[model samples]
Target chain A: MEKLQEINNKAALNASGALSKLIDRPVKMNITMADVRKVEELSPVIGPEEIVAGVYLPVTGEITGAALLIFPKESSFNLSDLLVRREPGTTRKLTGLDKSALKELGNIVCGSYLTVFSNALQVKIIGHVPSFSFDMFGAIVSQIITEFVQKSEKALVVEIEIIFELKALKGYFLLLFELPQFNAILRSLDSV
Target chain B: MMENIEVNMGDLVVTKNQDKLTTSAVGSCLVITLYDLKFKIGALAHTMLTDRRVSHLKRDALDATSSSARTREGGNERRHEIRDMKYVDAAIDEMIKKMVTQGANKENLEAKLVGGANMFPALKSDIGKENVLAAKKKLKEEGIRLVGESVGGSQGRSVEFSVASGIVTVKIKF
Candidate 1:
């Protein structure tokens, strides 16, 4: 578990570096938690009723699972402003352009994390096209959990704290893998 | 003071008093409530999937819950097998049975439904729609009158079902 956490920390760092490069700004991210959890325990990180923007990327290949990136309402708008080059705090509602920008941002962040894992474990991982949704935090997360419940009962949850320009943002990046695939991942790490 | 009971995912709560049953962050999952006005008894279920029969993880989930059902608190160990109440069909049936057991008249029971939202439109998943349909079908089979519902959208909803008034309030973040 410690080794897995360490790998996730490195992956988080890689994701932050990629995000900084994309937005052309210095971005800092801290991995608040990196551990395995039951699917039921994954939705309470943010208030269920709180509005949030989520980017979901279905992962295939050696691991059949999904990756989810979440941002609270204010942080989503704030990040959208930065991603689309609008004045900070100006994005009240997400437009098509802003949504696309968010999806692109999700792709980059998830891709970076997958890249690090693939390199570390010598596993081929593919992230499909990203899907975006903005809704209640519980609702968004429930859909993903339901999707995975058809296959697995557990997930690897990674909570992250993102800071940009002195404004701290609470975000979550979750990875879900089937039990066998998850064990394979751990075994690969053991060999490493 | 009216008591408030929280219903978690794949769980059901039945009461004969004025307690309010609440559940939040409902996306794709279905919340079914049954009430008998004359008896003043009601039950609420937070169901996750359409049907357990069609689910591939039914065996695994049940086995997992069975083992994890043991808990030690204050040096006392307790063991209880938890039924996977997340299936719409099973959950609604269980709720009706519980309501009847709690003195709710089967003939006088009315029903309300909430949740069942496709939070991600791009995913093209029909679990939400399927769950809603399954619940409706179950209610019909059970002869429960469908009184009110707030369902089938891209919005997440939080629900509060008052057993006293048979009033179901659904809230969503605009």
Candidate 2:
């Protein structure tokens, strides 16, 4: 019990340090109840009342599983406008010229989360081109979890809410780490 | 008086008098054409799927008038008229008929096929392969000889046919 507790504490410290380094600032690390609230409130669009959506990285250990970043239709459009510098009321759908911007945003958000994981765990990870779809959040989450998550013994999921004031857009980032990869990180923390 | 007719997706167009018919950037789709050199008539069908299973529900109304109407007519006239209808099977059959109507013998008519590219890599369903197989089966059943074909690859193709010469030129891009 003592050894496992030491490992867990060390892992948490390592994760915190890594996130701070990656963001170039100290990050308050933990999937605590408070952090959950922060994730929700950061964006006015994704408040505490909204349902928790799932974003998956299916091939997590193998070249990074497919990562799905879900945003509300309105939030997605707002983010697209901010990312592309489009004027308000651009009348463009997310599927139109905004596809490229969405892709880039996914890359950045997913990359940031993975950077934290890699630094804390000392693992090298790479991601592929991101694909986005606007659908009922539950349906999308269920699909990803069934296709990618259920196959694993366990998964490390980090849920964060991102806010951009320019667009008044709020959305969640669900990072799913594969079981084996998470275990390896745990082991590294034990030795550390 | 010969004028070229351009065929787009989900469409069939026929022309006589040596006019050229063309379609561009065909991906995961089949382009089948029957030309009658003597009659100077030709028809082309660009189909995205091998079977009508999915389209069956959506195309039921259109199919009712198309399939049964062709069966009621006799050889050349029936074939030519049916080819005037849309969809894969009828379009090929009609092309052969139109060729015969234009004075080309059924046995002497030549069929040319092109396109069938796997455009979506993530999709495991091989629509392109299915289209190629369906085109081959349809042509064989109709007793139309396929003199030339360019099918089945990851690249897109653009095809142009000369009804006057019964020649099909296919340009492929990787």
Best by DockQ: 1
- Write the residue-wise lDDT of candidate 2 on B2-115 in tens digits: 566767555677677768888765666678888766666677876654434334342433334344444534455343232323346666766666666656677766688886
True contacts kept of each: 0.87, 0.00
- Give residue B20's error in model 1 in angstroms: 0.5
Question: Which parts of model 1 have CA positions greater than 4 angstroms off?
Answer: A1-6, A9-17, A24-33, A39-44, A150-152, A161-163, B52-63, B66-83
Score candidate 1 by TM-score against the native: 0.87
Q: List residue ranges in candidate 2 displaced over 4 A.
A: A1-192, B55-86
lDDT: which candidate is best? 1
TM-score per model over all chains:
0.87, 0.44
RMSD of every candidate to native, in Å, equals 4.8, 16.9
Q: Write candidate 1's Cα lDDT for A117-172 as tens digits.
A: 77777788899989999988878877876776442367777777778888877777
Error of 1 at B136 (Å): 1.3
What lDDT would candidate 2 get against the real structure?
0.54
Candidate 1: residue pairs that collide? none
Worst 10 residues of 2 chain A by lDDT: A31-40
Provide interface RMSD per model, one decimal. Answer: 2.5, 15.5
